[model samples]
Target: MPESLNRELLEVSAQVRGLLQDLQNLGFDEVPLAPPTAGLPRCGTAGRADGGEPGVSCRPESLEEIRADLENSPCCDLCRERGNLVFGVGDPHARLVLIGEAPGREEDETGEPFVGEAGRLLDRILSAMGLSREEVYLCNVLKCRPPGNRDPRPEEVAACRPFLERQLAAIAPEVIVTLGKCAAQALLQETTAVGELRGHWHEYRSIPVMPTYHPAYLLRNPASKREVWEDMKGVMKRLRGGGSR
Candidate 1:
């Protein structure tokens, strides 16, 4: 590796160490995590490439405990540059979860997910669905923004995977709608593109998932909004007891 890259990694490691120490100092250590139990979704390693199917280590009781657990588990280079961890926002017991790829400049600054131009479009989309931001949960596959708004690295995604699972397990949403290809593929553990995945019903830890074109994509390709609406209609039907197809 180049000297500069080595130095950068060292810096990120130091940052993680400091954060972990702070969390421990504030009494965030030795928090027990519940083992996987029967009757819930089988929380296997969706993103794991090792062909292992172990479930999530723990299922926190509430969003507060889940967030508290995350404070001590920093394990990514994004930690070095992030202003704040965009954990998530919305109802604690939401039946709907809208997940995106990751945070952008504005979200990284605000420490809230989906608060940019894309967020405005999402708000409008939510209104059309007869919902509000407070009615559903909003989050991302990756909590921190990549430097320069670039795509997230594989290591970064791995670092944040457990937190996302914990969130899903905590809220136990009835439906999940992935806003972009990245989020969909990450949760589904598939390589299929968004165009092929949208307008269909999929499963994530036994919860129903509906993939759709991202609002960011619609911003560039405005014609795709029609397709996105069609996909969301399916989600609404599922929520209204229409059942899965």
Candidate 2:
């Protein structure tokens, strides 16, 4: 990375660390959720990849406890190395869960899921269908950043599969919206183009899985946005008690 970019990243990491500390020290009342910036990444700030602050680790006995444990636990390599673990976000009982391929720079930094440029577009897309970030769960196949932002290797995906599975089992969402071919293939254990995987629903251990284009891909290939819309419509229709489109 260029010196300027590296400096900017370091600065962003410091801010995120400070913000997290404030949240822990003060309380929720000290800060409130704000509207996301237009066109900017939804995930706020980045942090040191070497794990900024020391996090607590304790095993939970129940699903809710597991969720909390995941949040607090820093046992995972990513969690221990990165200042934060990019856990899934949204209502615990959300009717929909949106899964992505992996965490990008924004997500890895802030320890939040779906907060990059793609995430911003995804929020808009969901809003168009009468949903918001809080209405559904958002996560990724892998919790860490792959070197050079390249595609996740099979080993990396396998290593993270258990965690993702646990998260899914905990949420027990009615529907799952898988972004990109990677997530679709990983969750469904199939090898098919996103186009072929979309427009219909598949079953993942009895949960509904709907594949669609990753927002990042759509960013580079705007033409695919139309197909994404079609896939999202299918998700919304199902959410509304209608048959999958």
- Which clashing pairs does model 2 show? 43-115, 51-81, 51-82, 51-83, 52-83
lDDT for every model?
Answer: 0.86, 0.77
TM-score per model over all chains: 0.76, 0.70
Best by TM-score: 1
lDDT assessment of candidate 1: 0.86
Looking at candidate 1, the ten consecutive residues that score lowest on lDDT are: 41-50
CA lDDT of 205 in candidate 2?
Answer: 81
List runs of model 1 lying over 4 Å from the truth.
1-60
Q: How many angstroms is residue 77 displaced in model 2 relative to the true structure, after the best TM-score fit?
A: 5.4
* Model 1, residue 40: C-alpha shift (Å): 18
